[model samples]
Target: GFLSGRQENVLRDLRRQMTQAAEELRFERAARLRDQIMAVEQVLERQKVISARMVDQDVIAFVREDGSAAVQMFYIRGGKLIGQNHFVLEGAGEDADACEAVQEFVKQYYQTAAEIPQEVLLPCDIAEASIVQAWLRSRRGSKVEITVPVRGDKRRLVEMAQENALHALEQMRAEMRARLSNADRALRELAEALRLPEPPRRIECYDISNFQSEAFVGSMVVCENGEMAKSEYRRFRIRMHQDHPDDPRMIREVVSRRLSAGLEGEARFTKMPDLILVDGGQGQVSAAAAALDELGLAIPVCGLAKRFELLILPDEPEPVALPRNSQALYLVQRIRDEAHRFANAYRILLQGKKQTRSALLEVPGIGPTRARALIRKFGSVARMREATLEELAECPGMNRKAAEALYQYFRDAEVREEA
Candidate 1:
């Protein structure tokens, strides 16, 4: 071999002289001798080629609570050598012992590599390829191959991961499909739950509100595409009964008025509703349905039963129970609740005015007729404050003296009230 003891000793001596020359700044001579030293080292590494190429294809088996895994590696042959190359056997733990075990294996392998021994197999506690690569890199070594294979228990572990991944992919695809589906089909499903003919793309829900049926009012709210169409909403004042708070009769009146206006092509209520919803049980729904029939309209009708929040469809054996998280259920609930709130708010507005005006009109000089005339003339009590005695006299049926006296009384009353 070129790396014989005599030749190696000579090369070492040449290196030492080159170092001394560099210390003394002998640039030209140092450069020449450094080339000669490198030539000798190159020859020495050439003689060690057999030792480098005879590496065993080492394999490692790893086990965890999950399963088992394995890895394989081999040494490279024929390269310019300055230092040794190291490769990690995958499926090893991150503990210090796992590190030391690999170090010992590499060291022992290199020492007896010339003997061409059989492959060495080790037990690894971890199976992650990244972790194995990290451990090998820290050693400043190269020319190694690392691999982790699925087999035995390790096969089962990877199989589970693949199955879960497949299932997740399927679910994601299903969600995408849902978005592209027709909105009409979704509404049809909602209609089926309510036992309506086909799906109701356009729906109007009505709700009545009052304080003991005194200042009763009803509101009609429209919904399209499973959402509120706020612009189509309408409010109606109950001009019928002010005594009996019968929701059924109230529904009939409201639905009849709404349909009649829609049939007449009123600007705001021109379009006909596909379905009608009442915020009550079967009785209210029947009343509204009869009204629609009387108007010669074939609209489907349903009711949102208050008890248990059930959807009561006409002629259905039982109420349809929709899942609480369903979009269809939420859509109907929104329409019902909004109609109820609007009706109640309108009722409150009328009641507040009635309470204020009814008491004031009961005064000796001012009866309900005079009170109505005064309100019509003044627009509001606040505006009445700005009216002169002559303006009050101009109001129908008010004499000049009576108008003066009435104006003075209100001015005094407003002052006392503000105080």
Candidate 2:
């Protein structure tokens, strides 16, 4: 419409200016104008006439896979498909959480959106439809409709948006893998530095987390081709004494159990890592090596000390140091950091469960069984604490007396906190 208006030759003249700039050696200016030209062309290509009312609308759909999601939005202006945009959200959960992903995108996106359309179309039903509609209406200063079309033309549009979203997500993943293709250089450097038979294609790093001597846990994080292989990650609850956890012994036990499971052909642990990295000095490396020896496995074992970034090999008494800024050392450090993060996550989860159990067990008529039931039903301590007497009584295996005791306990606790 703008082209058909007074500035009909704007795009044509813009292209001419870009070509003239290149001829005059203004490459940077030409490149920028070229980008803007391409953007306008893409907008033109996305336009398509459609059947709809006078109200402007935005159709939203998303696809999720492997902890990432892509949301596709189609803008409809005056019954025409004007254009669309795609957004990516990492750590957005799986396909079953599609509604939640869409809800999140909607809430966060509209906060920064320049304009709110009169109507919005969704691919699936969301629990906060009414709330979102209310907010949208307030923004628009009039009524706004949010619809999930079950059939017909609008449904087809939503399906199209979903397909586009899925395609965009796969493209993003492929681009990421392409960027990581240079991992071969890092792998080669590591192999040369360590004098290995070949580069370690699958490297696993382990770290331990605990408080004083309680809730000791070990985490094994994997890096294949310089990218984190999160699905292969494993966590262990130290079966040995937690009252005074021995770091080396805990590392040994975790490594032994993992290797044993793989040896026994466990479903998820059947594949052994090419190299093992422990988050400690010589002692941790020795412990991991001992585990391998007892199992008759010959995997390479190494340790990365936190301070000074020293690499400790099982066979070498003196620590081996790589270049200060070598990719090989950087890769090792990245893997170690991932292991630390995973171990801390597991530790935090255990600590939360411990606190929940302790708090619930203090309530009269609530034992371990009820406490476990409460956790299973409510999924968190905060949610359970907020449950009313009727809600608690309705929980599985909970009687009126136990529910009343919990209700009264929280109520009195709240009163004391207020005081």
Best by lDDT: 2
Give the CA lDDT, 0 to 100, for residue 56 in model 1.
37
lDDT of 2 at 208: 92
Residue 213's lDDT within candidate 1 is: 48
* Highest TM-score against the true fold, candidate: 2
Candidate 1: give the clashing pairs. none
Model 1 lDDT per residue over 51-156, tens place: 3345433443222222221222222233223222223334444433553554455454445445222333234333443554454444435434443334663343
Q: Lowest summed lDDT over 10 consecutive residues: which window, candidate 2?
A: 19-28
Off by over 4 Å in 2: 1-178, 394-397
lDDT of 1 at 303: 90
User: Scored by CA lDDT, what does every candidate get?
Assistant: 0.65, 0.84
How high is each candidate's TM-score?
0.51, 0.63
lDDT of 2 by residue, 158-221 (tens): 9988998888788667645533544666688888878899999999999999986788999999
Per-candidate clashes, comma-separated: 0, 0
